[model samples]
Target: MTPKAILLHLRLPFSLFLMPVYWFSISQSPHFDVTKACWVFVIWHVLVYPASNAYNSYFDKDEGSIGGLEKPPAVDKELFTVAWAMDILAIVLSYFFVGAVFALAVLVYGLVSKSYSHTSIRLKKYPLLSWFIVGLFQGFFVYLSTQQAVLHPYNSLTNNLLPAILSSMMLWAVYPMTQIYQHEEDAKRGDRTLSLLLGIRGTFFFTASIYSLTALCFWVYLPLQQFLLFIVLTSPTLVFFLNWFRKTWLDASQANFKNTMWLNLLASFGLNALFITLLILQK
Candidate 1:
C-alpha cells in the first residue's frame, strides 16, 4: 500500500471517540504517571486502533464510503501486513509501559477486533454480538485499560467500574448510529449491522433510549455540579441529533454519509471537550 493508502486505512479521525476514554479514566484516577499515560495513548491510538481499522478495511475492501473516509483508496497486501505489525507492536509496548496483564488485554482486544472482520470468524455478521463486543471493548475495556495503565501499582480493577460501565453504555447507544448510513454496503457484504437489524426508526429509538439511560447513570454517579456541566456541554449535540433525526425521518436520503460524518464529528468533539473540561476541573 502507498503512504496515503496506509493513512486512509488507519482511519485516524475515528480515534476521536477512543481518545475521550483516556481523559475520562485519567480524570477519575488518583494516581497519574504522565509518561506511562502518554505511552498508553500512543499504543491505543497509533497502534491498536489503526491496526483494527486497517484490518477491517482489508477484509471489507469497501469501494463505497467507510467510517472516517468517504473516498477510501484501494487496499493491497501491504495493508494487512502493516495492520498485524501494529497490533504486535502495541502488545509489546503495552508490556513495556504497563505490565503483562495490560499487555494481555491488548492482545485479546486485537484478536477480537480481527474476528469482527475476518472471513472465517466474521463476528460482524451477527448484529447484536457485534454491537455488544464493540461497545464492551471500545468503551468499558478501554476505560479500564487506561485507568489501570495510569494507576498500575495503586488501583484495583473495581476502582472505577461505574464510570467504565457508563462509558460502555454511551458507546452502545452511539454504535448503531454509526452503522445507520452503511446499511446497503454492510448488507452487500453479508454483514447484518446492528443498525440494519434495528431498522432506521428503531435504530433512532434505541439510541435515544440508551442515551437517556446513560444520562441517568451520570446523574447518579457524578456530583450535581459536574453532571450539570455535562448536560450543558452535551446540549448542542443533543439538539443536532434531534434535527438530524427529524430530517432523516422526513427523507431517508438525509441519513447519508455526509450527515453521518457530521454527526460523528460533532458528537465526538463535544464529548472530548466535555471530558477534557472535567479532567481540568478535577485537577
Candidate 2:
C-alpha cells in the first residue's frame, strides 16, 4: 500500500478522541507497565484502528467522507481483503501480548467495526444506532480492553468499571458533534443521522450541552491530584460550547466545524498526555 494510504488509514488525529481512557487506565494502575502499554497501543492503533478505517472506506464509497477522511488515498480493489487480513492478524497477535481474553475482545471489536460500514449491514445509515455503537465500542470498549490487556491477570471489569463508564460518557458527549457536522451530506445520501433529526438549531444546543456536561463529569470524576491538570488541559472545550451556541449558529461553515473538532481533540489529547506523564513521573 502507498504511504499516504497507510497514514490515512491510521487515522491518528481521530485517535486523540480515545486517548483519555487509555491514559486513565495507566494513571489509575499501581503497577503500570510500559511494555504492555506499548503492545496494546500497537494492536489498537497500528492494526485494529487502521483496518477498521480501511474497511469502512472500501464499503462506504463515501467518496472518502467517513472516518474523518476527505479525498481518501486510492487503494487497490483488494483493499477490503487486505483490511480483513490485517484485522485477523491483529486479533491473533493479541493473544501473544495481552492473552486470550484480550484477543477475543479484539475479534469482537473487529466484527463490530466491520458490520458498522460493511455493505451487508451498513450501520452508518442509521445515525443514532451508528453513533451509539461507535461511541460504545471505540470509547468504552477500547478503554476497557486496553486496561484489561495492560493490567493483565489482576485486572477485572469490576475494578475498571468507573473508568470505562466515564470514557463511554465522554465519547457519547462528543459523538454528536461529528453527526451535526455531517448532517447535510448524510441527509442528501438518505442517511437518517441523529443530527439531521435534531435539525441545525437543535443540534447546536445538543452538542453544546453534551460537551458541557462531559466537562463537568471530568471534573467530578477525576482524582484530587488530577483536577487542576484536567482543567488546565481541557479548558478549550468550553470554547467549543461558546462558539457552537452563538446566535448565528446556523452557519455550519468548514471553519466552525474544524474549530469545534480541533478544540475537542486538543482537550482529549492534552488530558491523556498529562495523565500519562503524571503516571510515569510518579512511578
Candidate 3:
C-alpha cells in the first residue's frame, strides 16, 4: 500500500483526540515510569489505534467524517484480514508489557469499539448510550488502562486520575456538538444519536451543564497549584467554549462544526500539556 493510503487507513490525527488523556494518566500515576509510558504510547498508537480505525472504517462507512478519511479507498480482503489479525496480536502482546489486567482493558475496549461499528449491535444508533460509551472508553477507559499498564500495583487513584477524569468529563460534555454536526447525515442513515434525542436546545443544556459540573469537580479535586496551572493553560479554550455556548445551539452549521473541532483539540491538548508539565516539574 502507498504511504498516504496507509496513513489514511490508520487514521493518525484521530488518535490525537485520545493521546493526551492517555499520556496524562501515565504522568500523574504514583507508580508511573517514563519507560512504561513510552511502551504504552507505542502500543496504543501503533497497534490499538490502527485496529480500531480499520474496524470502524470497514463498518461505519463514514465516508465524510472530517478528521477521518472520506471515501477511504476500499481495503482488499488481504488488508482487512491482516487488520483483524493485528488487532488480536496487539491486544495479546500488550499483556506481556502491561500485565494481564491491562490486557483485559484492551479486550473490553476492543469489543466495545467493534460493536459500535460492526454487526447489528450498532451502538451508535442510540444517542445517550453512544455518547456515554464513547466517553467512557475514549475518556475514562483509555486513562484507566494506561494507568494500569504503567503503574500496576498502585494503592489508590493516581494524582493524575482526578485531572484526567475531569478532562474526560469535559470532552463528554461537548461531545454533543460533534453529534449535532452530523445530525442531518445520521438521521438520513437512521442513526438516532443523543443530539437528535435531546433536540437542539436540549443538547446545549446537556453539554453546558456537564461542562459546569466538570469545572466544579476539577476545583474540588485538583491541588491548588495544579488547578491554577490547568486553568491558565485551558483559559483560551474555555473562553471559546463559553462564547460558543452564548450563541444559539439550534443552528448546527459548517462554521460551528469547524469551531467545535478546534475547541476539542484545544481543550484536549491544553489539558495534556498541563499534566505533562507537572510530570516534568515533579521529576
Number of the top-ranking candidate, with lDDT as the measure: 1
Which residue segments of model 1 deviate by more than 4 Å?
A: none
Question: Per-residue alpha-carbon lDDT of model 2 for 168-274, expressed as tens digits?
Answer: 77777766666666666666667777677877667667766776776677677776667777677666666656665673365556424555566566667777777
Model 2 TM-score, 2 decimals: 0.87
Model 2: residues with Cα > 4 Å off, grouped in runs: 1-3, 64-67, 73-76, 247-250, 254-257
lDDT of each: 0.87, 0.72, 0.72
Worst 10 residues of 2 by lDDT: 247-256
Tell me the lDDT of model 2 at 245.
Answer: 62
Ordered list by lDDT, greatest first: 1, 3, 2
TM-score of 3: 0.86
lDDT-wise, the better of 1 and 3 is 1
TM-score-superior candidate, 1 or 2: 1
Candidate 3 per-residue C-alpha lDDT over 119-223 given as tens digits, one digit per residue, 9 for 90 to 100 = 589887887788888888877878777876777565455545676576579669867866655666678778888887887667778887997898789789878
Best by TM-score: 1
Q: What is the TM-score of each candidate against the true structure?
A: 0.97, 0.87, 0.86
Order the candidate numbers by TM-score, best to worst.
Answer: 1, 2, 3
